[model samples]
Target: MPTSTRTVAEELLYRIGEGDTERIAELFADDVDWKLDWPEAEHGRPATPWIRHRSTPADAAANFRELAEHHVAEGAATEVERILIDGGDAVVLGEIRRTARPTGRAYRARFALHLTVEDGRVTRFHIYEDSLAVAQAFER
Candidate 1:
């Protein structure tokens, strides 16, 4: 029997908590519809480095890697409030806390992650968060 979308979403969350980039990439389809809901240009500055266009599973892994590179690992945490699943889609509501390595400033922001799974792999991934808070954290 094929894996359910809920199972795929749960596994993805588990792997993310484990910080397993390879495992996370394995959960994605080759060509994924990835989107980060943040302004590309804010005050004439470009978006964060990790906010690039991504399609392949390798790009997904690289995205996580870039995020880690930009933030302090210590005291970083994700508090998942809830997960709602229906058919092939899952919506994860959570808050993320991280300190920016560049400025050593910490920011906490609520997030909504939408994942669409099909054929046992995630085909679409979209995340909405407080971009201003995150950007301020990296400001000098």
Candidate 2:
């Protein structure tokens, strides 16, 4: 069988949910531009990711260099709610349940991504989410 856009998107999220950094990188193209938008902008840490690209697989690997040492590797996470795909453009409307430590409280935030695919990899991605919800989730 061949890989469809919807399949690719599903697999990508599945990989992320599993915290498989390698698999996540594999799903992105060499020139993949990952656009991330965080609701924390007005709080001073304006998280606006216009693009995230690499020239080669090595570049992609390097991009995720920090993931290898992230404290939350064994996170208990899942994409609880989502409205998954759109053929070549995948859109996921969901909330991710994750925690840094096993004893920590689960952080919940809503997300919606508009992804463009090419050669089975994600070429461009634009993210949208309720920043307010994210901020509230992070509240002390």
Candidate 3:
């Protein structure tokens, strides 16, 4: 894995692929922050969406925890196919397959995530997915 931004991002992907939430939590800092290109509805909801995402390490940890939980029980599993990183940012191309969380409908969607790492943790993220496909799957 990389030691700087790229490495950190790879490690993050590794941990996620391995279903290692504990190690994933350790990568974040106390006052890490983030953003999203999708919307509040994708991750369910985040209370307010107008303000910038100012999250603590606990928040990051919980985010993964929720994802991990959902993946095993409710959501699809992510299958990473390719990844590229520069400085503290990364672009991941992957796909997901399984039942949609909360909707209980089968779906498969291609995804690309732009991520930024800082202090050995993910500080920002923007998610891009086939929303129309996801929505269609959820309806079935």
Judging by lDDT against the true structure, name the best candidate.
1
Per-candidate TM vs. native?
0.92, 0.64, 0.70
Clashes of each: 0, 0, 1
The sequence of per-residue lDDT tens digits that candidate 3 reaches over residues 37-84 is: 554555454321222353666666566666544333545577888888
lDDT of 3: 0.65
User: How well does candidate 3 match the true structure in TM-score terms?
Assistant: 0.70
Which whole-number lDDT from 0 to 100 does residue 37 have in model 3? 51
Task: Residues 29-96, candidate 1: write the lDDT tens digits.
Answer: 99999988876665224336888679999999998887888888999999999999999999999999
Q: List the residue pairs that clash in candidate 2.
A: none
| Model number with the top TM-score | 1
**Candidate 2 worst ten-residue window by lDDT:** 43-52
Query: Cα miss at 49, model 3 (Å)?
Result: 14
Give per-residue lDDT, candidate 2, residue 61. Answer: 54
Model 1 collision count = 0
